[model samples]
Target: MENKKRIPNWLKIIALLIFIIGGYFGWTAYTTFLASNVTDNQKYLYINTGDTYLQVLQKIKDQKIVEDPNSFDRAAKYQNYTESVKPGRYALTPGMNNRRFIGNLRGGYQDAVKFRFENIRLKENFAGKLAENFEADSITFLKLLNDENLAKSYGFTKDNFIAMFIPNTYELYWNTAPEKLFARFHDEWKKFWTKDRLAKAKAINLTPQEVSSLAAIVKGEALHKDEMPAIAGLYLNRLQKGMLLQADPTVIFATQDFTIRRVLNKHLRTDNPYNTYIYKGLPPGPIMMPSIVAIDAVLNYKHHDYIYMCAKEDFSGYHAFATNVAEHQINARKFQKALDERNIKK
Candidate 1:
């Protein structure tokens, strides 16, 4: 057999050097693009609207989501994520590599926030709450709510716009714009008013807005869910008889002093239109964002001749119903005596 030619020493050395250098680069690339770079902890990255890429990087650094900031920055730049930053709430999971993280940021792969609003007493409070979970500021949401033209477009007045927002949990992106959010609420409101519900409103000779307003009053008065229908019926009776609602909750809303445990004569005398004792019909809008339970109670109210309601003396959160002035006075006296015993003189 012919003898194999031995490779030159210098050429062997060069080949070995090339192999070592290539292996080192390949390992570095794997660490930067494929190896787990995110910390092994659950973390959320909130990128606000108009945020710069550098700001987003700073947020990541602040949250301590990534193991190496330089490697993440390198991956972001390589994937052109620095030029295509998207505003959103993103979830950073364990074992996430820089490549996948940068891809998510560039592709707008964001997580949805579980948004819930209920028992909100005022539009300002609602706006503030929205701002807490969203990229938009409170002022932005308030401006949209107060926009008369925008409200009119959705078939609602600025005062009654709160009625459109049904109290429930929703899945919404954190960066949803104010206009889109309002549209979503309007869509939900429409979904709530089915044909059967519309027919019920017509039977009661009330609009959906009116029902919502009454439901808010019912909610404020009745502490127990079982008593909501009776309270709603009482208010309906007062409405039909052209009697003042005289709802104490309305007076509380009018006074804007939520700490008042007792509705005194002074509270009743509040000059605001929301004071049902002063106004003849339901106030301009709902006093609060009524619950679905209260709204349904108004739609299916308990029919009765009783026109007056007084909280029971035992503070059991139940009410005593009466048909005549004498019985109502008796119930009122019992409640008043209880209040006096407790020294609740607000």
Candidate 2:
């Protein structure tokens, strides 16, 4: 038999060394790219608009979202996430590998925020809320809301623009731009005004905006949902007779002192156009964001001859309706006496 050339000891040692080194590097790569790197607890990562990759990394580090920062950095660089940062609100789940995390950041795989707003009293307040949830700042949202040309494009005046935002919960991406957000609201408003709703508006001789404004008044006055239709009807009667709405809520809004529990003569004397006691028609716009129930109440208001309303004396959040001054005065007196008893001076 031909003797096989014995492998050289030096060569065998070199080959073994190479195999060991390769295995070590392979294990390192596996840990860096495939092993769980995220913290055990779930967390949310908010990357604001115009954020650089370094800022995003710092946010991750500060939040302690990753179990091994070095591994995450290595995976991020390998996946080219450093150059492909996207603005968003992202969810970091437990047991997420660095590769998956970097991939989500690179691909803009973000979570939607459950955004909800109601009873917002001012555009600034709305803006602040938007800023609190979105990547855009409050000033950015305010600028969009105050842009006359932008409002006109959406068939809304700056004063009535808030009416477009129906009070409800929405699924919105946190990176939504101000213009896109306004467009989304306008889309929702259009969706709300179906053919049936449009016909109802026409029957009442009120535009959708007018309905929203009246609904806001109805919302402010009636705390009980069952009483909304009656209150809405009362206001409709006043509107038909060209009577001053004379709504105390309007005076409260005009005074901009939301703490006023009682609308005194001084409050009614506020000179702003929102003071329905001073202005003839529905104030320039809604005093507050109205609920869907309130808006529907205006659309389906009860037909009645009553032209006046007074909050009930028992503080039951119900109202007393009246057709004439004498009846209204009786109801008003009862309520005034209740207020005096409670020592509600404002």
Candidate 3:
């Protein structure tokens, strides 16, 4: 009994206090780590290429996503996430804690960015759009695209490199390199030109690039999708006859004046290789980015004897086809008269 009394009340109180303090600290740490520490308003975090740990923490703080950045920092350090910074778009939701957030960064569970483009007209515009959507800048992308040797290695010229990109949506990492982007396009191009497509191209006696070029011309000449096949056929007829394409769209391209409502005799004499009237063949490159519909239209061109076409006098976006020069001239005269009446002199 005396030995039992040797265990004093003050020592017992000290042991109880120690246990309570340890439990409180442990509960606080568990809440900070395992429990939700993210604000309800927080949704996502964007980690750019080559971001350091501090930058990531600052971005989290700036976005007001994390309630305790210090706790997150400690977790990240413990998980060795501070050294491995993954660059990408990350998905976050409300009520996420330091454990989950750090685990995502450490495991590199980033969201894939959706990439897409359409109706692009100019190379610069294409480059700018790509830059806006990707990590690469416009100048760097343009330079790589225009590298003649690099393009030749891919069996394309700088002029026809635009053909490699088929207009569609793609999923890729936000921090994809410029070279990787080019390779992805190349792969997509290969996938697009399947055996059946290759056979169709062979039957038409045109390379894929040539088909895309003609498709661009066809797309430029017609605003209505239904007219593409017939316009493609008309141009094919002219090509077969060894005659000038004489496509007004090519003249507009040569003049670089998209605002011209009418192609006059003066515009046709621009003397550029893109001027189909003077070149007597396909242009060296596409006049604009062609749609997949336009490309398929060229491949499945309607068999027709028509060699001429003119925009109809009606303001509706349609065209009139002619099998002979006389009919074509009449159609042209009618269109010119309509233009004159509308005071569209340019």
Candidate 4:
């Protein structure tokens, strides 16, 4: 009776084969196609705190960025990265696989771009150039340059104006808003001055802002980097003694033009507070972004009773300083002689 009821061994084998094949196909569909990094090309993934793996998966699917989340999950589980995702803004692209797309999102790669404001003086020049390059509407950039409201928002006093702006290289994304661009630079400036550097400035009775102003003066005085510290000392001595800084760079800042061959009498009387030749006490704010050399010079300036300085004839990146008017006159004459010999019209 048991032998008569026994099923054929071949039929059992065929049924088992069908079951194995079907299981294999179902597993592939669940892991490879249905579970994976599903990101919508058009949707933005905002990853802040408290986001879970399932929430992330749902977002990927809802945005239509991925055709299947099940495939992504299966792959992620296999790699043991199912719960190791990072939190930040993530950008997803089309046709991305589960592991590749999930990995980037978990890594938090933000979009960015490169830009520079180094050696730039005029506001409109920087604004127009950057705006045009970023397709941000040139007119809008120029308006920001001239915008008093924006100026005031960034700790600018009524008198500070554009002088508070620090010039340097920068990187930003194409979608970066105008306000963000301004704030980013400001933040960078704050971090640029280290704790030790800040202490050094404080020891010299100069705030970070004051140090920057002094650095700007050093920048205008020295044609060569080697001359910076010495020139910086001369100005510091003058400032300590209540003497006029009388820096030529101040005149350039006041005029908003750097082409002045000489510091004319009229330049001293300009309306801008940046004119150190006329106004006193650090010109109300920084005149320009100073290099590290300038800042160091101010912090470690050579102390001297001498209140006057002029360009040395040697142009060896050093200046010949003087203690009195007679000595100053001699030094000035020597510089003038060299200038004349070289046919420099100053």
Top candidate, metric lDDT: 1
Candidate 4 stretches greater than 4 Å from native = 1-111, 145-153, 158-169, 264-272, 315-317
What lDDT score goes with residue 327 in model 4? 96
Better of 1 and 2 by lDDT: 1
**lDDT by residue (tens digit), candidate 1, 1-346:** 9999999999999999999999999988888899999996556888988999999889888878898988898888888989999999998888899999889889999999899988998999999999998888999999988888998998889888889999999999999988898899899999999999989988998999999999999999989999999999999999999999999999999999999998988888889999999999999999999999999999999999999989999999999999999999999999999999999998
lDDT of 3 by residue, 1-346 (tens): 3545477889999999999999998987887578787786555687888899999999988888877877777778877888999987788877888888888887889878788888887788889988887778899988987888878877788888888889999998868888998899889999988888888888978999999999999999889999899999999898888999998888999999999988889998899999998998899988888989999999999998999888999978898889998999999999999999999999
User: lDDT value for candidate 2?
Assistant: 0.91
Off by over 4 Å in 1: 1-8, 40-42
lDDT of 4 at 326: 100
For model 2, the superposed segments whose C-alpha errors exceed 4 Å read 1-16, 40-42
Each prediction's TM-score versus the true structure = 0.95, 0.94, 0.91, 0.61
Please report how far candidate 2 places residue 141 from its true position, in Å.
1.0
Q: Using alpha carbons, what is the TM-score of model 3?
A: 0.91
Better of 1 and 3 by TM-score: 1
Task: Write candidate 2's Cα lDDT for 1-346 as tens digits.
Answer: 9999999999999999999999999989999999988885546888888999889888878888888888888888888888998999999889899988888889999999899999898999999999999988999999998988998998888888889999999999999888898899999999999999999989999999999999999999989999999999999999999999999989998988999998899887889999999999999999998999999999999999999888899999998889999999999999999999999998
